[model samples]
Every structure is written in C-alpha cells, then in structure tokens.
Target chain A: MSHSFRVEATADRLPEANAGLDAWWSGAGLPDEARFAFELVLEEIFMNVVMHGSPPEGAPCMVDVILDRQGDGVVMEIADDGLPFDPLAMESPDTAAPMEDRRVGGLGVYLVREMMDTVHYRHSEGRNRLSVFKSIGST
Target chain B: MNVNIESTEGGVSVARAHGRLDFGASAEFQKALEGAVGAKPKALVIECSELEYVSSAGLRAFLVAARAAKAGGVGFAACALQPAVKEVFEVSGFSKIIDVQADLATALAALA
Candidate 1:
C-alpha cells in the first residue's frame, strides 16, 4: 500500500502533513512507537525544508512526501525543490557535550538518522530527495 | 499547547506542559520557558505527564531552555515524560545532556 501528500514549505502546513500521515498510519496498523518515530522524522524533514532549504526571499517552496509499505517495513520519500542541501551531509553534533558548550539546532537531523533504519539523500533536477526506511513494529 | 507554571516553591519553578509540543507550539513553549527562567529560580522542572506529543521543534525548545538555565545560573530538569517523549529524548541523546527523572517527586526533590 502507498500514500502521498504535498505540503507547502510553510510552518502552518505541518498539521496537514501530520494529519495525512495519521490517517494512513491508522489504516496501516502500525504500533504507537512506530508511528511516533515516523512522525518525528517527518516533522524534522518538513521543518528543515520550510526553515532552511527554502529561500529567504520568498521563492516557491514545496515538498512531496510519499509513503510505501514494503514487506515488513515502510519507506518514506521526501522531495523538495528548495536548496540543494543534504541533511545527512551535515556534521553530527556532539550530543554528549556539556550544556555550556552545546550548540542548538542540528539535533533534528541526528534524530531522523537514529530513528530510521536507512536514510539516503539525492539531489536531482534541482530538487533534494531524501529516502527514509524503517521496519514496522520495531522501535 | 498550554504551558502553565504549576508552582514556584522553595526556589524551584515547576511548569506543567500540556498538549503536543510540535512545530506549532515552539513559540508558546519558549515563552513559558522564558517566564520560568526569568524568575531566576534556583531550579526549573518541566512536568510532562500531560504532554501528549513532542517533535524536533519541541526538543529544540527544551534545548534552548536548558541553555538559558545554564546561562542564568539556574538549575533545569524534566520529569514525568510520556514513554514516546522519552524515546525521542533517548534517540537524540538529550537524556545524556539534560537531567530527566522518571517522576515528578524525584525531580522536585533533586532540584531541592
């Protein structure tokens, strides 16, 4: 089974992205933990596109999210026409660093990588595409 | 999202966060944190028993509040995290950097 949705790269559109996933996840019969994992990853990717990837000068911002159930796992594809930035390419912040020396932000990418089983990035035709995979019923 | 300051007793400021702390709630979360930190309480505790959901944006708010507490020489901690919220903290390694207690009493006592 598969589901897809498009979101304008606006903060307000987050609820739509979330609602769309909620409806499908309910029908997909995923556990609470698995659903939370997917929700976190989607929020991170969607917000990144809305806040950083999109141009500050008001360029058109759009993101396409596709979900597919494969065997015992689910795969999510996020594609955006914003900047050509690969979230995976960013350096991981030292999570163990003390509060005084810690840097804000960048935790989103780290969480996405940790929650998903496999994450791949591609930049094609002026678009950034990210594929995230996770096994169903697994935390 | 609704963040109500539950109490400020014995130099400990306790804030009860309710509802989803996702992207839409960041501003409200930050405002509440600011109010808590502004009091310069010796310690700050965010009770999350009523919090239903948390996303990266919510985590970011927590991080920012933590930083503010450190800068202001105030103690900060979180307690009563729902299981799913705890998982997010663990996965992001935030559990290592911040003080997360399993319940409200322990968190308040530790702050005291």
Candidate 2:
C-alpha cells in the first residue's frame, strides 16, 4: 500500500504533516521501529527543504511525499519544488569528534543516512527528489 | 514538546521533556534547554523517560545545550531515553559526546 500527500514548505506546517504521516502509518499497522525510522527520515528531509531549499524571492514552496510498503521493506520518496540541491552529496559529519569540536547543525543529513538502508537523490525538472528505503525488521 | 524544569537539593537542574521533539518543536525546546544551562546550576540532567520521539533537529537542541553547559562549567547528562530516541543517539554518535546514564538515579549520582 502507498500513501501520498503534499505539504507546504514552512516550519509551521510541520506538525500537521507529521500528524498525517503518523496517522497513515498507524493505520497501515507498521511495526514500532519501522514507524520511528520513517518518521525521523521524513522530518530530516522535509526540514532541509524548508530551511535550505526555499527560493530567495519568498515564493511558495511545496513538498510531495509518498510512502509505500514493499514486501519486507518500505520506500519513501520526497520531492520538493525548491532549490536544486542534492542532500546525499553533502559531507557526513564527523561523528567521532569531541563535543567541543563538533558542529551543531550538520548531523541531520548524517543521521538520515545512518538510519535508512538506502538513500538516493536526484534533481530533475526543477525539483529535488530524494528516495529512501528501510527494511521493517532491520531495526 | 513540554519541558518542565526543576531543581534538586544538590543544585542540579532537571528538565523533563515529553512528547515529540521534531523540527516544529526544536526551536522552543532549544531555548528552554539553553535557558536551563544559562542558570548555571551545578549540573543539568535531562530526564527523558516520557519523551516519545526525537529527530535530528531535536538532537541539535541537545548539542547546543551540551555545549552551553560545558562552556559554563556545568555537568550534564541525560537518562531514560525511549528505545527510538536511544537509537537516534547511537546512530548520530551523540551517546559518545554527551553523558548518557541508564536512569534518573544513575544520572544524578554520576553528576554527584
């Protein structure tokens, strides 16, 4: 089964988007760990679009999300009509760094990469498309 | 997220966080934690038994608070994380840089 939705790329809309995603995942009877991974990954990518991918002219930006359960794993695809940026290309944060030397904000993409089984990014037709997959029982 | 701050007799400030700490709630949570650190208690312990969820944005709040506590010469630790939150911490390697105790009692005792 697959669930699809669209959300405005604004901080204020995040809760609503999360609520909708949670409701769908719950109804689908996903395991607790799978649900948690999906929630975290979605939030990471969505917030990145809201924060760094928006246009400079204050144009309205929107993100499209699709979540699908395929056999023993789940796939999530997020497409945002924002700047052409590839999140997968970003450098991984140094997780072994000491607290005093660690950069505060770079851990989001790194966490997403670590938690998900696979992540792919593409920029096509003026949109940033990111797809992630995770097995249900891996967690 | 709802963060209730209180003080122990040992001058440790314990902030208990409940509910989801995602992108939407991160800013407010960060301010609350930073405020707790700004008070300059002997130590700061975050009680996370009731915290249901946390994303990377929420993790950033913890990072900022940890840095502030270190800079201000205050001890810091977090305890009783739910499984999902614990997973996030481990994957992000926050369990290394930040002090993580098994429970509230252990957290307080470690700081003592």
Candidate 3:
C-alpha cells in the first residue's frame, strides 16, 4: 500500500508534505522512534528538493511516500522530479567553525544521517529518490 | 514540543524544553525565548536535558534570545543538551558564543 502527494518545490509546503506522513503513521500505529526518523529524513530530503530541485521556481514535483511494515521495520521512500541531486554526497557541515564563520546551512542533512538507521539515494528518470528504513524496536 | 517556564521572585526566568528543536519549531521557540527575555529577568536558564535534537536554525534561535537578553542587560545560558545536539552546537561553534551548562541549577548560577 502506498500514498502519494504532489507539492510545489517551496518552503511553505514543506510542513504540509510532512503532515501527510504523520497522518499515515498514526493510522498505521508507527512507533515514536520510527516516526521521528521519518520526519527528520523526509524533511531533509524534501527540503533539498524544494530548495535546489528545480529552476528555483519551476513546477512542483511528485512525492511518493510508502509506509509498510517490513518485519517490524518501516520503509519510507521520497521521490522528487525537479533535479538530479543526491543528499548523501553533500559535505558535512563544519561543526568547528565559529558562529560567524559557519556556513548558513547544510546541518539539516548531516543531522538526518546521524538519526537514521539507513539512508540510500539514486538519481534515475530525471528524479531523485531516497529511501530510509528504521527498525521499530530501535526506538 | 512544549517549553516549561517559570519566573523566580529574583526576576530570573528558566525554561525547560522538551522535543526536537529544528527549523519547524524554530519560529515558536524564538517567540517564547524572546518573550521570556522581554520580561527583563535578571537571568535566563534553558533546561535542555529533555531537548532531543537541534539544528543550526535552533542555534540561531538561541543566539536571537541571547542577543535580546544582552541588549536588556540580562544573561542567557543553555543546559544539558543531548550528545548529538551538543555536537551540533560544538560543530557550529555555538558553544563559544552561547554559554552551555551541565544542568539547570548550574545554568542559573552561571549568570550570577
């Protein structure tokens, strides 16, 4: 079973897309830990597409989020059709930099990696899709 | 996310924070922190023990609070952040600008 939502690549719609996942989780009885993992990773993935996905103001893309219980673990896949960029390749934000010296962004992706059990990305069909999985017991 | 806050007779305000501190909640967090500092408290203590996660936006929110408190001649300090969150503060070098403490009691006194 899978549900899909198409959203414009914009920051304002980020939360809306997230809420869809929350609703799905609630109905499926997803645990708190797994829920958090999905929220974080999805935010990072979705926002990246919004921020850098298209022409900075191009057409919105479709996101297909599938929530299925795979042996007590939940699998979430995020697909975007704006641009071809993989978040896993992005450099880690420099924690050592002073406040004034630190880059303005990039911490979101790093934190996502820290909190998730597994993350994978692939660019095909001119779309970037990322899949994340976490065991329910991990929470 | 909920912020548990109370003001002491000494004019000090302390906030107990629980939940992930990220961009999603940064707006609300910034508002609450500013509201506390606006009361002209002598000091501010942020209990972050229960605070799960924080991003750079979270750090910016704290900076906004600190800057406001500084303008008011009061002080601000953050306490007991989770290791991962703490690492973020450390990575962004927020530890240097924002005074981080081991516990609420310690943060309260740090301003004294």
For candidate 2, write residues A61-108 as lDDT tens digits.
899999888767889999998988888877888889999888756678
DockQ of each: 0.78, 0.86, 0.31
For each candidate in turn, the interface RMSD (Å) is: 1.4, 1.1, 3.6
Give the local distance difference test score of model 2: 0.89
Report how closely model 2 matches the true complex, as a DockQ value. Answer: 0.86
* Residue pairs in candidate 2 whose N, alpha carbon or C atoms collide under 3 angstroms: none
User: Which window of ten consecutive residues has the lowest lDDT sum in model 2 chain A?
Assistant: A25-34
* DockQ ranking of the models: 2, 1, 3
**lDDT (Cα, 0-100) at B32 in candidate 1:** 86
Per-residue lDDT of A21-60 in model 1, one digit per residue for the tens? 8888888777766788888889999988887788878765
Q: Provide fnat values for all models in the order shown.
A: 0.89, 0.97, 0.19
lDDT of 1 by residue, B29-110 (tens): 9878987998899999999999988887788799889888988999999999999899888887789888999898999889
Q: lDDT tens string, model 3, A1-139?
A: 6656666667777678778888888877666545665776776677787677777554766666666666657878888777688888889867666444556466777766766677888988887888777777742
**Tens-digit lDDT track for model 3 on B1-112?**
6787898766779998898776678889989999999888898888898888665567778878888887788888889987766776765567887889988778767777
Q: Tell the DockQ for candidate 3.
A: 0.31
Candidate 1 fraction of reference contacts recovered: 0.89
